[model samples]
Target: MGSVEESPEEFTVLVTGFAPFKSEYPVNPSWEIASRLPEYLPRKDSSSSTLPRVRIVVYPEPVRVNYQTVRKLIPTLWGPNDPKINPPPGDTDAGRSFVPPAKIDLLLHIGMAGPRLHYALERVGRRDGYNLRDVDDQLLGDTAADRADPNWVWYGVPAALESDLDLDDVLQRWRAHSTDRDGVNHDLRISVDAGRYLCDFIYTSSLAHLWKQGARRRVAFLHVPAAATPERVAVGQGLVVELVRSLVETEWAARQQAGTDNKTDAKESAAAHVPADGADTVTGKWYRD
Candidate 1:
């Protein structure tokens, strides 16, 4: 396969951040980081030889931190794959046809972890129940004892879904250039526990949706430290953006190579079974002259 050119190619990515949940802090770090991502992403100029043209749409999901809300919104944000159903974000006027944009190439979900010093690239989201309470002192999950919420997101899903992201690649890029306000390198590590709360709930639901649609090289969840100060939040945002860009470029190149190789293999296989001159073409089988 030939090398993937560095020319400009447009790719759409959907990044989502949850609202302030049980935390006491007035501002949610997850939403803050997502709101500022567009400023850091590369912009397209007139020069056609520029880097990949990335159009990132940051959608802030303001749904309440509850099992019912998460369950309903997942399909809304990610439109249905079945042909009979209309696309999402707008399904008004049943007879009128409206096709939503293509399925996002990458879906990166960000949620704020507890007050910590480093960011975590979450590896697994468990299916166990969340029995915690939100800031309002209400139950966050819908277990048998809690209430009869019939539409739980992880109702019949697997026990756990390990992230398909290349964590090693994300970590390598983060360690190479990430730093804090004090010039101290930030600690970025692979984390197995995504917390048995809404974070895990949403992450697991995302993976399940993508899997059902057969979307590859697509989903990842990032846990950002609860940055207290504005400067700290800025630093965390920059690191996260850099890591995302690296992953996107790497995946893009890989897909290009895979496509080229598949075409080449198909051509070779076709030639190998082709009939020679003056062969028995009527039988639809290859024969020597």
Candidate 2:
């Protein structure tokens, strides 16, 4: 590979947040963080870069996190390898690979979810004026649920990615927003199924796409607390910066390795396809009927 190619090139990272879950003002910290990812991963200059560098995308929060919807939207956002079926590239440089490299690619999922199950984070990580009561009101409004409305939101995505699967190699380590307290991992209640919620849909959808393409890097989803105050939002934003930096660095490194390996494999495969110098046609090369 050329020296230029070796340098960190513009890879794509998709950062997403959600809209109102049911009907709420949305103090969603994950959404808050997702909304500001572009700001967190800023360029050298003061202004924002107008390129498809590191993309920050936000998906609408459906009333219910339908599994089929997840199946639909993943392909919807990132689109399929076949250009004809998917929506047009939003940016001019979207499909075009970066030259000198505009940015590193990342796919992030962040959202505010209720703890309905065992793997729920005890701390909602909310500042003043924010509490279960408030978030409850926001989500449930006047509706009442006794002890049993499924509120446990599991985004053990961090855990899910690390595990090895037979279908495709996974993107294990991802950069994510940093927290002031290193209290996330320990006593960590881990759960695999985030239910059939939108989060699950998005996560599974992304994984399916990357896996199908044999994409080297993996997708990570972050579930944040519903921030109540502006201060908490600021804190959330800081964490987002940390997460973005961490995930981007990890992904960039992984992608570089993947690209290298892919090229090496291609070369080897090409050799197999090539025939003797005097031969006119061979295997795997283009053939006209």
Best by TM-score: 1
Best by lDDT: 1
Q: Roughly what TM-score does model 2 have, to 2 decimal places?
A: 0.49
lDDT of 2 by residue, 1-289 (tens): 1012322434455565665554554455566555555533554233224322454433333212333333444554554344544442222233222121123245666656563211121111111111122212332221223213444222222222311111011111111123223334311122333443455455555665655555543456655555446776665666555555545554444445669787422112223332322223324432211
Q: List candidate 2 stretches off by more than 4 Å.
A: 1-8, 23-27, 39-69, 86-104, 115-193, 255-289
Error in Å for residue 8 of model 1: 11
- Candidate 1: misplaced stretches above 4 Å? 1-8, 43-51, 61-63, 80-101, 135-156, 177-184, 260-289
lDDT, residue 129, model 2: 16
Score candidate 2 by lDDT: 0.40
What C-alpha lDDT values do all the predictions have? 0.60, 0.40
Backbone clashes counted, model 2: 23
